[model samples]
Target chain A: MSRREQAKEENRARIRASAERIIRTEGIDKLTMRRLAEDAGVSLRTPYNLFGSKTDVLIALLEGAGFDPGDALALRDEQLVMEQLFATLDHIEAFFDSDEKFYREVYGGIMSSAHPDVRSTNVERVVAMCQELMTHAAAKNELQIDTNTRELGRYLGVQLLAVLGMWGAEFLSNQESIRQVRRAWCGILLQHCSNASHRAVDAAYQSVALTGS
Target chain B: MSRREQAKEENRARIRASAERIIRTEGIDKLTMRRLAEDAGVSLRTPYNLFGSKTDVLIALLEGAGFDPGDALALRDEQLVMEQLFATLDHIEAFFDSDEKFYREVYGGIMSSAHPDVRSTNVERVVAMCQELMTHAAAKNELQIDTNTRELGRYLGVQLLAVLGMWGAEFLSNQESIRQVRRAWCGILLQHCSNASHRAVDAAYQSVALTGS
Candidate 1:
């Protein structure tokens, strides 16, 4: 890579780190472009040029904070399709629980942003991750033949977002949020699973039900 | 009722009516307490005294717009449990579609409110409505004997809210939003349904899957 490109990457990373620090020390509301630029030791327009808007910066923060689907797939390579999906939920729970205040605030910023493109961009990323997994499961004959993997992925993606929304809204705790997503996953996948994979999915459902009570 | 009590009720109705008009004609952001007072011909403190906050006013607006769970139950008394649940989703879709701009703005207002109580109050009201229906389904042996109806209800309630969240966020169109919710409902209920209800639930699942594709 060229020196200029390397410098640009370094600047991006520094800005993101600065944004995270600001969120941690202050709050999402305080992490404006001017504030971020000053904290990161860059010009005022640097943040705007690097990131389109405040919403873009928050999306970058989320992506940097392990919101990438590719990373999620790589992290659970050893598990079965159903187990892998549950693991994804576990990963999300852990991520949110790791820093509840930070995530809640960041998520609030993203969801409440006036820019619809940013919201859909984030939702589509998660949906693609789910679709990739469902497509893999379908290739292995784990899911039912009639299952529209893409649609199911979209459904799961929206469900996960909803669960996260509930958590952000303080309607569900982190643990309960994961459990709720698990229950929905198991319940939805129960009908979509092939006979060969039904047992594992059912067991997961039973576990969620048992623990929920 | 005493004359004073009756007068207070009249003020509330008038204020709510004016609030809706402002939201419908202008937008949610323009329906402040002061503006509502002028529009409703009440004292500026009248809105505050009656509604507590702008969030409370939105909640009242939502309830007035047929968001009450009791009304949902009454609207589908003749349908079976499964049908009743689906009907409730349909009811929500119609309500939102009836005036997309108005409901979307109002929903955005409520969800983004600083007060968490109003959000939970709305969520709990929907959850209770779902639980009541699920309990009735269980009593009739329509659901599996060991199914946790309450948990299932909470799952469904949260799912519905998530779907609405997607709609409010403009991630899904109105029809697509309802389809997503129905698909989740059918998938989740497929496993918990009794033998007699299995065919019906499966049919619903197939319908959602087909429509979704």
Candidate 2:
């Protein structure tokens, strides 16, 4: 990379890391622009120059964590349906590791928001990912059901989100919580497969193979 | 009721209603001793005298909203199975609606707690209720499966908890979210019923009827 670009990257990284640490210690509500800039050992204007505003910084932080800038929408189509399912679930756990409290704060805030951007953008991304997962799973005959796969997928994904929110909030953490969730998820999928009409499964698989779905 | 008992009851109701209003308007974290006193038209010392602490007041608020004192044990009994399951769930929902922000605060507090009183109490209550639900459901041959019914019951319960938390966090309006949850709960229950073997069902029904379970 060019010297100027490298310099800019270093500055942004410093800002994000410092911001993250501040959030870890003080919490999302306490993460002020001045505090972040001071924590990063830079002038207050430095953050404004780099991030524009607190919201931009938040988007940047979440983007860094694989929730923003279309990360949820970028699932690899090459993977098997089950692999995709587990991998995304893995992301839910890892996201908790990165910044647990921030996840809860953002989740609680965006979900409770009346703003159109907040509502539409967050819900659509989740619903889109669900549709993609369910459609692919159905095509592979891994998820069979008479019910709409899109809706089922959405429900499961949101369920994961909910659990993660609870975990972040600190409502769930038995030695067995994750194991329990996995079993429950497995049961849902297994039942869905069992419930699928044989003809429906056959048609879906056939259509998928021919259409590269 | 005796005069002193009646006065205590009035104070309790007054505290709960005032706390609910404050939490709804300004959010839960902002629920300071001073604000509560101002809003409730009582002395600042009154809260401490009446409930001992903010957490105690919250517990009372939840109790006032339908959390029975003996529910943790009552819901675990086989004889009261259906009443237990239904009442436990309805109380859970009532807590969500009694005051959205306070519910978030307390539920958040409960979930992330290292404190035994906070975490263990909730866990004990849930596990007891689930075990009771499963035992009854299994006895009726409603959930005959290869795995333990108690474990299955817990798994399903957590999934519902997870979903309800997100839904309560306001991804949807309260009414619609509750409706969706009830629908999903039925779907889950029906799937279990369908998968149970005939022998298991007959034995379960007999067990349930014999014990009036």
Best by TM-score: 1
Off by over 4 Å in 1: A1-10, A74-79, A210-213, B1-10, B74-79, B210-213
How do all models score by TM-score?
0.88, 0.68
Instruction: Report how far residue B153 has shifted in candidate 1, in Å.
Output: 2.1
Work out how many backbone clashes candidate 2 has: 4
DockQ of candidate 2 is: 0.18
Candidate 1 per-residue lDDT, tens place, B40-74, comes to 99999999999899999887888887776568755
Superposed by TM-score, candidate 2 places the C-alpha of residue B113 at a distance from the truth, in angstroms, of 10
lDDT of each: 0.81, 0.57
lDDT score for residue B90 of model 1: 74
Name the TM-score of candidate 2. 0.68
